[model samples]
Target: MTANSPLANPADPADRGHLLTEQANPRSAQLDRLSALELVDLFNQEDQLTLAAIAGARQGLAAAIDTATEALRQGGRLFYVGAGTSGRLGVLDAAECPPTFCTPPDLVQGIIAGGAGALVKSSEGLEDVAEDGAAAIADRNVQAHDVVVGITAGGTTPYVQGAIAAANRRGATTVFMACVPADQVPTEAAIDIRLLVGPELLAGSTRLKAGTATKMALNILSTGTMVQLGKVYGNRMVDVAVTNTKLRDRALRILCDLTDLDRQAASDLLDRSNQQVKLALIMHLGHLNAEAARDRLAQHQGKLRQALEARVSG
Candidate 1:
């Protein structure tokens, strides 16, 4: 209803600057008339900003990871809510957690404004509905222990704002990620992460730089948080779920790398442990049986490195 309110002009495309994927070229005069090689160089130069934006948000990201981890430790969930590219990125991150860290699907969840159908198709209309966003959180039964992250390029999506508001009301920790400056970031969310990669290559097209920044941040959040939670061991995805041929191959490689075991031995360990890479690693490294390996893992709180070290020391 007010000028600063997210619901005021939900339909206005310009007001959703953070959601806009296209950014105008500052060197429009030179870039618009450049040759192929020149254009390539220009685009490459523009992409350099994405990493810098991520670097600047390191502190905020670290805080978010800590908050999310604390919430998960207490039997809570992590929820990602957004629209369009932001929503898709959130879903992408959530989908990867199970295979990468062997986490439960419900541990990290993503909610798009327009639902599953909107993942592939653009459902711009849903972005304007405050109630739709609020309902998504309510239906999930978000509680005080949960951590909800709202993603929006422009920092002004009604759906994202509404979701953060609802999550906060329910006593859940709320984090907001956007491309705008901190001063321009919406005040509804508790933690504001502004990955300001500047404007897009095409005017108002946020999927360019903004999307890239969001993807990078999400990668750090999920991977870093998992590592902190002991899902990883010394740069290895120890808890990786071998659900496919590629993953099975990767698991074999991980065993070989960690224990210097022959292919046959690693394969035997993998089979003996039912394709659990961490358990296989522990069994071989710790020279323990499946049950003993599992018990050691539990003793170390699933930290393979610490468990292996204790075994070696003992």
Candidate 2:
């Protein structure tokens, strides 16, 4: 880079090194010249690196899940912070948690560099203002019980780095999700999840491979935390909000699977329990009224299996 380059700060780790994401991919040197089928084949081969990267980071990912689970169990919140494609992906994952596990929207929140408006428009410059990220963490009232995940594919987003630092100062559990190696952009967050998907198919366009891997990791983090929080029973999401016709069908299917009941019976049971799949199942299996089942569920801390085991043991 020239001396006039905006990213020419000698003190910044980001400005000093060769960014893996921005490096030209030798495999895709003739990308533009390739036929449609050739490009597709090349892209597919490159995408295979995403899963391998995740697999290599399995131990770290599992640690993140466990940390998130403990925090949420203690009535803490999870926040996803980032910018550009990384920020948008974080918002997408956070937005899906509620309806999927019946979690409150506040339970899982997303904060983009430029707020909600940046989700659509390109607020790329906002990520350069590192203080904004620190202020965002403070604005959310993050505490020791909270978990803040900073997503930055290039691993050099000043906004994400600042947020992680602020979150650390607040004594909150912080996880850093980055696509670059630790040596490229080192972080001090309690958990570091490196999704090294190599160089993207389009060189620096991390929205392709890095974005996919980040999305998958966020999915595992949220879904796995929910499962540990008793939002799931077996493979079924018992805490799912039956707000739509499709969800209603899923609720019925869950009930039918857990109990030897017909569709009509499950539907009736669901209605009697106010469409609460967990409550309905408990009501039917324990031979208790809706209120009694509700109390039992609460007593067992929303664990369906534990409640059933208690009933059998009692």
Candidate 3:
């Protein structure tokens, strides 16, 4: 599969020292000599670059969100592929989707080079084995409908690149995220998100600025996609899972805030909807029973706004 495909070409790891992320920041030349307070201040100043980098990649980020939302709407899954810190961040974002948006666990997944064990330990060495990444994609049975996001701070992790290549072969939509310029480290992904935060304060330690910027990007990508998927309603997470006391309290508050119900009434409404915040809101607003409200929501593809609008139009 790799012989003719342009996306399968391996990046030349030779002389990667010239990459912008590998360069030392002139401003941080005396980092070790700084006082404790000075070090804190310097880190704070450098961290601001992460925000700027995110802003710079606004278009790419928006494109990714749109692609992922549409794919998911069509019953496709979203996968984040990376290694080391990047991998852990992907897993973290994927894990939060279920509790935050009430999504199925498989709807969003994270694949690291060394699997679950790598999340806690340093499996950085596995990042160099390109085949492992490709095998991971095949293991997931990635298809044309899925969206695979490859993350590598320096733009040259063989593991991430391999996963992207394999995803492309399986006709999946591919997103490549890195902190270097395309000229420095090119990729054949459908969308390229470059978080150009320059070099880290500790020279090649990308876990500093690059990691911060990557985390910010991932947060935006996941949250924006969920919002577009109708998991959010007017800035509220309507699909939030009510699994514990805190979430039940939050669900009650949401009911009260969105409707005329008081805390006690909201709790009753929540019980009527089986603790589903979206269904409870629909049941109250649409003046329908729990089953009817659930059917309406399903007919509208789980969009509370659409379901309610249908009730009004009907």
Model 1 Cα lDDT, one tens digit per residue, 170-215: 9999999988776655556778898988777667777877889899
TM-score against native, each model: 0.93, 0.94, 0.95
Residue-wise lDDT of candidate 2 within 17-41, one digit each (tens)? 4777777789999898999999999
For this target, which candidate reaches the highest lDDT against the unseen true structure? 3
Q: Which prediction has more favorable TM-score, 1 or 2? A: 2
Order candidates by TM-score, high to low.
3, 2, 1
Between candidates 1 and 3, name the one with more favorable lDDT.
3
**For residue 265, what is the lDDT in candidate 3?**
93
Candidate 3 Cα errors over 4 Å, as ranges: 1-14
Candidate lDDT (C-alpha), each = 0.85, 0.89, 0.91
Please identify which of the two predictions, 2 or 3, would achieve the higher lDDT against the true structure. 3
Clashes of 2: 0
lDDT digits (tens) for residues 102-176 of candidate 3: 999999999998999999999988998778899999999999999999999988888998898889989999999
